[model samples]
Target: MGQKKRFLLRLDEKLYETVEKWSADELRSVNAQIEYLLTEAVKKAGRWKQEQGQSEKE
Candidate 1:
């Protein structure tokens, strides 16, 4: 875990509703689900680097 940056995100109603449902299904808060999805997307695209000595324990 690392320091989290906070900011505002403006999303369309339909998208927000969909994400809210998905988050509930995954047993995570909407914010957590969004972070999880973004992290996965970055990893999938090979655009994020693993911290030194960090393990892929996810």
Candidate 2:
């Protein structure tokens, strides 16, 4: 895996709670869920490119 740049994220209380619950339901940590959502959004926006014969990288 490539190095990941980390920083603080401040979400509203209700948003955090909602994400926490969704993450749990999907068996993912809160951070992973956020990354997954962001990645999906990027792909949907046509800004993400996939390497040939390889899955998406984070």
**Which has the greatest lDDT?**
1
Model 2 scores what on Cα lDDT? Answer: 0.93
Per-residue lDDT over 8-27 for candidate 1, one digit per residue giving the tens place of the 0 to 100 score: 99999999999999999999
Taking all chains together, each candidate's TM-score versus the true structure is: 0.93, 0.85
- The C-alpha stretches of model 2 lying farther than 4 A from their native spots are 51-53, 56-58
For model 1, how many clashes?
Answer: 0
For model 1, state the Cα shift of residue 26 in Å: 0.8
RMSD of each predicted structure: 1.0, 2.2
Q: How accurate locally, in lDDT, is each candidate? A: 0.93, 0.93
> Candidate 1 — which residues are off by over 4 angstroms?
none
Candidate 2 contains a number of clashing pairs equal to 0
